[model samples]
Target: STQNANETQAVVASVLGLSANKIACKVKRLGGGFGGKESRTIPLACITSIASYHTKRPVRCMLDRNEDMAISGQRNPFMGKWKVGLDENNKLVALDTELYLNAGWSSDLSVAVMERALGHIDNVYYIPNVRAVGRCCRTNIHSNTAFRGFGGPQANVIAETYMTEIAERIGMTQEQFREMNFYKEGQTTHFDQELKDWHLPKGYFQLKEKSNFDARKAAIEEFNKQSKWRKRGISLIPTKYGISFTALHLNQAGAMIHIYHDGSVLLSHGGVEMGQGLHTKMIQVCAEGLQIPLDMIHIVETSTDKVANASPTAASASSDMNGMAVKNACDQINERLEPYRAKGLPWKEIVHHAYFDRVNLSANGFYKVPDLGYKWGENKGQLFFYFTMGAAVSEVEVDLLTGSHTVIRSDVNMDLGRSINPSIDIGQIEGAFIQGMGWSTTEESLYFPNGRLFTQGPGNYKIPGFQCIPQEFNISFFEDVTHESVKTVYKSKGVGEPPLFLGTSVYFAIRNALWYARQE
Candidate 1:
């Protein structure tokens, strides 16, 4: 629980040189983190604690928007050089890439981020010989920390950009090239982990059919031929994002559920909601597992006092890990009341009977993702429980004169593996896509030569706004899909981060439009 109060307590203890047990940290809910609050929150807390300790009074630290932007870490900016070898049919044969990440200042999470970039450089494709190297370059600016997709989005963009370039060189559609290189069921990644259940091909064709990709592509070509200043391009990109923390130890999560005498359930897990609807999904998991109504579950605030030593809610595995832990706790309670259930006892009656029988109404659950082992140096192991698959087709119109672009239409088909809550999952997908779009297009960070950030606020920097959204946005989930390796609660996969990679399609689509624009 990166957002847990304990994180602040630990920092405070370290700063004040006191025992951690003497410190107390409490948080109600985060306004919005998106990975910023994961580790960045600790410094402010520690500074305040130190000041209070010295002055013998309460102290607090707050940063204005400009100050915050100047000090806080942001998504890592990467410079990648890649060599891709393709066969006669434009299938990827071998790929060698070197990614240099601008890790401003200290190595906050740059090493882990670099590893993630190296791991994700393939981006749903299977190449017989692939090697990706990452270098973290230290600078005097603010350190770059985690964002939504971690480093996976940057890696996926690198791979997709090269793929798009290769497709253009070979006179093939990006969609065709992508489909041909999609990982099959038996294919192994460069890390030597065999893909157990691959759905990218099915998702690719499904999205193509649903989006009328071929027809729209032809129509765009015809329209581009007539238009002098504007050109439209369409591209379909696929993602097979491995789900789980690359570090095997971070794969575990814990939850505590307590059922009241009135049959009301109280659930708390290590995951911080962060406005991602994680608590809502956890409630749903408890309700589903305990066979109780949704309204009967009350989600308490995440506290370290309740659930200790929790992992950070990241890598898109928050729901998968926390939901399973909640389910496990609920299942334990249900198992204890099974005898009463077999007798057709009422829910409240069962709880009363269990109370009298000394059955535990409160239970703690712990879940560790199994069979995940990765040696960073060797770059080989079953690091992920399973890969979340998706495909997106984006049609964009580019202004050749200004090098500006607008996404005309976008279609997304993702496999969320029997979503726990379809609405929440869809929201996550849409939000991630838009955020990634901003990263690829409008969200540019600039710095002065002396290492001061010039884009310190919205006045100087641009982010995607309402106008940046696609005119026609269609998002759908693959039907009847579930994870083959991990037994997640409700058989659902993580939805937080995978769809961000889908935004790479928009970049390539704009690139395609630029190609036509350049010809004019």
Candidate 2:
């Protein structure tokens, strides 16, 4: 495990016949990237830059299907054995897991990924005597990189699978088992982090009620009991996603806000958009902060030259960090306008008056969460932030003889911590859930013997189709849950990666359906 990112840069330079200084790499958004855009992109970019520099021409190289799949990284495939011990009421007591990650070639982000896996090994449950050890097994395949959920979904899947197995062993339904073990208020997790206001179980229970989880489970069981060729299954899945970058220092964020005389706003931050609507959400944040129309705010492209000394945009912390920074800037302007507001003028008029006063209407705000004490030798984990949970239930029908399955209906209830735009947030949740479903069920990657990927392009690989999406898709947010925002307009957490694990429920539902098929 070599420390520092520059080492990776140096290795890329040596392989590609370029000096490290000449690399001039730029970070940007990648559409539909499966963790391949992280450290794994350095080698390809270095090669391209070297080709361009030596030839003194516009040399362009792009990977075709096989080459791209071989060269590009993947979401690490993990094999873990978990034994969860629950008490009489299904309260989680202890958990032990052995995690083996297929960290192909050079370790890359494997250490961080595996550590994260171990860190979140218990998912949302409060389990004692939790023992999780991870080994990054070096293989001759392409290296794995960070996906949307990072290693969180993988680790959580293991825990949730344990939930399913335990439920089966105890002759209980999956929902009952999950509800019994869900994180309760004032409980300390395996990492010794005491959940100050943990509401995962409350949120999950609300979701269960809304999604008719009990009704669905009963129906599925009855259907499976009657059918010989087909079966049904349901699951209540929850996600307790930690919001900060695990590497402590990378958790800070900076933002620039410029408000013009006409009351228009220009916003710049480190986070990039990969069609996930990060930009749209940022605009909403700025608008809410300034108490102005959403149209008044404009988001600019993220650039190092503009927002200098910025952290890499990952970990679902962009909104939490940058949105707070923008709010800080807005507060500054609002403070200056307060005098005019004291004159009994409307806020807009106050803003207009302040603008004409030749107000120095530009600001840069920074945010680093305070009192987050993390020491290397402490052997303890205290969160700079806590996780928000969501529950998803998928009902699936499997054709036993054909070995095929269809998702007949799906229901989702997410606690996204005070959604700014309920409609937009729902769409995001639905999209991520669908994408994750594809990852588990439809999308599969292929690699050559020499560690090159074969399924590289859209032509070769297949994701989910419209037909595959459940017809009876239903979603709702938990009510009365305020965005406990300490720094921003509303205390809203990132809604990006958490819902991706909803696919786990879908996959397990399929598994349960298939189990019923096996009995038949």
Best-matching candidate per lDDT: 1
Model 1, position 154, has a per-residue lDDT of: 90
* TM-score per model over all chains: 0.96, 0.88
TM-score (C-alpha) between model 1 and the true structure: 0.96
Task: Report the CA-based lDDT of candidate 2 relative to the real structure.
Answer: 0.74
Leading candidate by TM-score:
1
In candidate 2, what residue range of length 10 has the lowest lDDT sum?
Answer: 1-10
lDDT of 1 by residue, 172-198 (tens): 876777777788887889988888767
Compared with the true structure, all predictions reach lDDT values of: 0.84, 0.74
What does the lDDT read for residue 217 in candidate 2? 76
Regions of model 2 farther than 4 Å from truth:
1-34, 51-62, 86-90, 261-263, 340-358, 458-460, 482-489
In candidate 1, what residue range of length 10 has the lowest lDDT sum? 1-10
Candidate 2 lDDT for residue 255: 78
Clashing pairs in 2: 69-453, 70-452, 70-453, 483-491, 485-491
- Candidate RMSDs in order: 1.7, 4.0
